[model samples]
Target: MFLNKNRFFSNTDLIGFALLALLIFVMLPVGLDVFRLNLFGKYLTYAFVAIGLVLCWGAGGILSLGQGVFFGLGGYCMAMFLKLEASSPEATKIQSTPGIPDFMDWNQIAEIPFWWQPFHSLTFSLVAVIIIPVIFAFIIGVAMFRRRVGGVYFAIITQAIAAILTILIIGQQGYTGGVNGITDLRTLKGWDIRTDDAKVILYFVNGGLLFACLFIAQIIRKSKLGRILIAMRDQEDRVRFSGYDVANFKIFVFCAGAAFAAVGGAMFTLQVGFMSPSFVGIVPSIEMVIFCAVGGRLSIIGAVYGALLVNLAKTTFSELFPELWLLGLGGLFIAVVLAFPNGLAGIYKDYVEPRIALIFKRKMHIDEDVSKYDPLEAAAD
Candidate 1:
């Protein structure tokens, strides 16, 4: 009887595990196709942004509109390193000539900017991907949280930051690669990105990273810190009066989300082999919020599903009906909000899981009440 109960519980977990495995198996074949693989890779990168937004906005109750800032920081840092590495050694020797970069040449820059000096090494660039975003978030989070600035004010401030960053990158053409951004990346660690093997490896890496993010988010959600975050979300004043430092908690999660966004940005740079200023603009940041909302703002799985679905639709519509793609997307968003305000993930939780569980239970005769024959409860057996 104990064994039977154990099996029943294991079966429940098994179904979820099996579904996840099936998803990975199916994606593998799709990712085998070079074009499809690249597109999926981009989806994973966007999912990363969605995950960060879910944590900050969904759990922490902090609606951050400037995740793009960190995303851009990491992308630009990686792009700068790749650009420097790909540059001809002869180009490096010219200190005062127009050998800084093509955009710099157009801007009449005779030398590399002082700030662009550290991006020469791939290692430094990788470190900066995480460090720069975390540091920036720390400063910004402290400043705003300490002063108790939030709600629409916080959102507007973050949006302004994103706008300013975009303009700065566009204006500083010499150092930032200007409006064109950075491109023409050839190799990553001696592996040709154009080759099939490299593409496959990147696909798996992206998949693994997405799973890791989900797992970590799950752990955080189950932790005490997560509870506090949720409490602050529901009632900040109550949480504060309960002797908790709400600002510190908000800052911690905000920085964590920023770091995750940076990771996504770096991964995106690797897959696309380019970074552009447009990626960190206000529009993209707002889109991140929409992605989370459409996915189920509070659920990590919902975020991933939403990112993949939205991007897939984007790809399909762009190819099939280029002119109407944006309209189609807008209509889809409205439909989701009106039909299922909780998003796709919520729909699954409400309508799908229960049916699945019922089917499984019926198939396994779970409701048969075999306990009626329990030997332990038998009289003088």
Candidate 2:
């Protein structure tokens, strides 16, 4: 009975999945050029984080301001493995140290750091991409939720963590590639990812992974666990009094959110071909939250659209009106907050979705009326 209730697809799920399929497989591919499609691919990476925020902040009511930290961690882990492969002894003969990365050699570090040694194993890095962020989130969630620390205090702490991590990455120049970040990525498993064909393949792979996450999210949203989260969010004391371990639920959702962000980060590295501290900083972390807010924090499907539209606007405005891009972005955010606090998804739910539902209901009712009234049809049957 539990399994049946948690079954993957509902009526709304089918519609949501179909629209996503049309967008990913048909519309974007047919309409956009290669370069533009690739840019949209980049935007899709952010959608992963935005959707994660939907689970963490929207449903769970845990507003993590340090999601970019997880995203950066995942990207950097992938970048490290690629960087090691790209900087083989044969490739670095020009440098003083033949086997080490160029950045290390440039910064006068003769040997690889102890920490970086593990990234040479691609398998380890792949596991670390998900595991590391999950671990970090677990630690943070346990510490904060157990102590009953939340709201603005939790946000401030996460923001501080983002600032600290960004500074550390910049300060550890030799170890981390410093401000330049881990670049010069060439191939993954001997196949050149820089090629247009590879980009297309990666984009599809990304879309598949995203849909997988979305399905998992839908399952969670429809399950008892998801209800517990919403209950904890709205009435923590009532939940705790009912003998539910509230902290555990918070920690689990937070870690899941972190894991999602990390996958997005890894995908961002693959699609963009670099990972940098710029994305790990306070500004980017806060921007990720905005992506969720603008999408309708409560709507997972809306989150994807929000990320795509916001990034599209950013790219378009930044190119055409470089001087006024920030101003425009600020105004857009202000408008979203003031006019539609629930976001694009809320608007759709309140207005557009009702009309669509009415049409379907009318058709269904007509079919029912015909079956009831047509005595000749019944006799034929």
Please provide TM-scores, in order, for all candidate models, with all chains considered together: 0.87, 0.93
Clashes (backbone N, CA, C under 3 Å), per candidate, total 0, 0
**Local accuracy of candidate 2 as per-residue lDDT tens digits, 1-381:** 334335667555578789988998789988988788889999999988998999988888889999999999999999999999899999899999999989999999999988889998989999999999999999999999999888789999999999999999999999899999999888998889899998998888889888988887887777788888888888889999999988899889989888889999999999999999999999999889888888888888888988998899899889999999999888877988899876888777667766676677697774433232233321111
Off by over 4 Å in 1: 1-18, 30-32, 90-99, 368-381
Clashing pairs for model 2 are: none
The local distance difference test score of each candidate is 0.77, 0.86
Candidate 1 lDDT, 1-381, residue by residue in tens:
546433422343345445654575465455457777777778778888888888888888899899889888877777777776655456445544534665665667767777878987778889999899999999999999999998788899999999999999998777788888987766665566767677667777877777787667766665678778888888999999999999999999898888878888888887888899988999888877777878887777688778878888888889999999989878877877788765776676666766676776789988855343443412111
Global Cα lDDT for candidate 1 = 0.77
Worst 10 residues of 2 by lDDT: 372-381
At residue 125, what lDDT does model 1 achieve? 84
Candidate closest to the true structure, highest lDDT: 2
Model 1, residue 227: displacement in angstroms? 1.1
> What residue runs in model 2 are displaced by over 4 Å at the alpha carbon?
1-8, 366-381
